[model samples]
Target: MFLGLDVGTSGVKAILVDAEGEIAAAATTPLSLETPAPGWAEQDPEAWWAASCAAIRDVLARRPSARVEAIGISGQMHSSVFLDQRGAVIRPALLWSDGRTTAECREIVTRAGGEAQLRDWVCNPALEGFTLPKVLWLRNHEPQGFARLAKVLLAKDFVRLRLTGSIATEPSDASGTLMFDPANLRWSREMLDAVGLPLSLMPDVGGSAEVLGRVTPGAGKLARLEPGTPVVGGGADNACGAAGVGAITPGEAVSSWGTSGTVLAATAQPRVDPGLRAHTFCHVAPGVWYVMGVVLSAGGAFAWYRNQCARELAEEARDDILVDEAAAIPPGAEGATFLPYLQGERTPHRDAGLRAAFVGLSLAHSRAHMTRAVLEGVCFALRDSLEILKALGLAPAHLLLTGGGAKNAFIRQLQADVFGLPVTTVNREEGGAYGVALLAAVGAGAFPDLQTAVQRTLARRPPTPPNLDIHRAYEEVYDRFRKRLVAART
Candidate 1:
């Protein structure tokens, strides 16, 4: 058995997979992100480690420890985890979704010769969500904490340190830090100096399949694992997710709609979009590149509506309103439109000031109409990403769908119609965990390579075809969205 762990924003998940790639056991523990101020998102690194250990213990309790072969980790990207000389967490981790460093991002862009130099080095424009800006934010706001930093690591690296007493990160996770040069696959000294950070603080970069070290004896007792079980260097959640869905080849893509939405496309060459909308990062596949466009809120919009807007309906059903409410409305939400920018947005429009709004709502629209419109709006936002991918000349051959949103047939059909593509879900929806398991298996020499391991492990579901008439209707609506975005920008 191999253990795969995903340290997500809200929770830590541990999955035990047997040599045959079947799930033997799984466990999860909830966590929270702290918002000390507006646009500032933080999390206790100790909380992630504690939750992960508990989750590991729960999973191991269901299976024999001796059967566990290796461990792999996949986690949220771009979060800065600082540590002091005694290896204690210096402060709360600044998460990838945090938007408190806009001024720092602007400074980096200016020092790096504006957006052009940033694109030349990182293949994307500077953003407040990235690690460098967070580092700068700490430098400016918490000079005491910045001075005490002995090591600066990403989220997964922090967990790995707890598990193995080693500080290291994989290339895929490193690429998102904004200080790593994706083209060269190393930390960017030029950018680091520009940001006034020391280069020695970063961890050594490794491949996703490389085994960093074994679980320490102390960690073994806490998690009920073998003392010497190898731990592989896993990747950023999205990179592992791409591997999970078997979207390794060029022209293949993964369209994921979780709390946030992302459209990821594999490419042979690093290609930056002219507008710096989509981010280009090095893929875990080594020689390949992947471009990703992120939406801040996707399925969260529907959840918000269910909890905040349709409280009466939710109170009446209390348990079974999701399906009934979603089924009551027709496609396209009966001409109602929603802008899914509740928590601002990423990709195409990197504006933090923008707010979500429901447009074209009429008195005839019911609660179900608003609910369905929320779902459609999420898909339309994802379509914006797909359109950007197409413009970059990297159209996807097939889009593998994953996450909680893919479980709903109503939303799945909406995605198919909006993108006019064959949207397919994998048999297993746990993309990040599955991908980490594959990396562990590869590290254990169960498979010759990552690609073969993925081919053996990944299972596909039937494709959902787009409804041509509905797709045409979406084309017109999408055009309106495009026009509105352009007008807003101007």
Candidate 2:
């Protein structure tokens, strides 16, 4: 058996797969975020550690006799976790969704000479989601805490540190930091100097599928695994999710709608957007990279609507009634459009100050219209990424939809209509954990290569083609949405 562990923004998940790539068991532990201040998102490292232990134990309890041969881990990228010399967490880890680093992001751009130069150096724009600004924020606001910081690790790397007592990171996660030079697959000394930090502050980089270290005796006791169990260097959450859905080839892509919405496609080399609109990061496999555009809020916007505006419909936990009711509304929500930028946005604008809005509302509009507008709005945000990827020459043959949003057939067909592409979902909606488990199987010699593993593991359903009439109507609505965005920005 091979184990794949994913430390996501919302929870920790553990999935167990056998030699044939079939899942045998899985478990998950829910987690909560701490918004200590406006625009700040954080979670205690100890909480992650606790949740990981419980999830791992729960998975191990199922089929106790199963011998886990290898373990691989994936996690949310760009979150910063500072550790002292003795490998102790310094404070709560800042999450990728946190928006408190806007000023620090601007500082990075100025230090790099300009926005263009920063793109030339790291192939990415300085955004609040990246790690460099978070580190700089720590140094500026918490000088005493900064003094105790000896090392910085991304989200999963911190969990790996607890499990293996080693400091290491893989390329896929490292590329998101705005500190790694994606082309050369190494830490950028220029970026480090620009941020006024030493190169030694970063962890050693490794291949996503390569074995990093073995489980330590201390962690083995809590996780119920034997010491010396091989642990592989996994990948960032989205990269692994792509692998999970068998989107390893260049023309393949994954459309994920978790807390955020993302469109990620595999590429043969670094395909940085000339306008710095999308992100180019290392692929989990060697000799390739992945380009992605993100919407800061996707299902998150839907959840907000459920909790804040549609509470009456959620009494029996049938919040899906919103989608059911919205299905009765016509295309375009009858002239209403919603922007899913509650926490700001990435891709295209890269604007952190932009906020969400519902336009064209009238007294005739009902709750059903609002719900339909919300769903359509999320799909429109995804289309923004799809259009960007097309301009960059990385368009996919079809989109493999994943996450909770994918479960809604209405939204799935709506996504197909908005993007004017065929969309399909895999049989398993396990997300990143399943993907890294495949990576673990490869590392354990259960499979020869990633592509072979993917073909053997993942299966897709029939494609949902876009409706031409609906597509034409959405084209008009999308035009209006774009104009509204530009007008708001101006």
Query: Top TM-score: which candidate number?
Result: 2
Question: Candidate 2, TM-score vs. the true structure?
Answer: 0.97
Give stretches of model 1 more than 4 Å off: 64-66, 310-320, 483-490
TM for candidate 1 is: 0.95
Candidate 2 Cα deviation (angstroms), residue 3: 1.1
Q: TM-scores for all candidates?
A: 0.95, 0.97
lDDT of 1 by residue, 170-230 (tens): 8888888888888888788888877677889889888888999789999989888878899
lDDT of each: 0.83, 0.88
Best by lDDT: 2
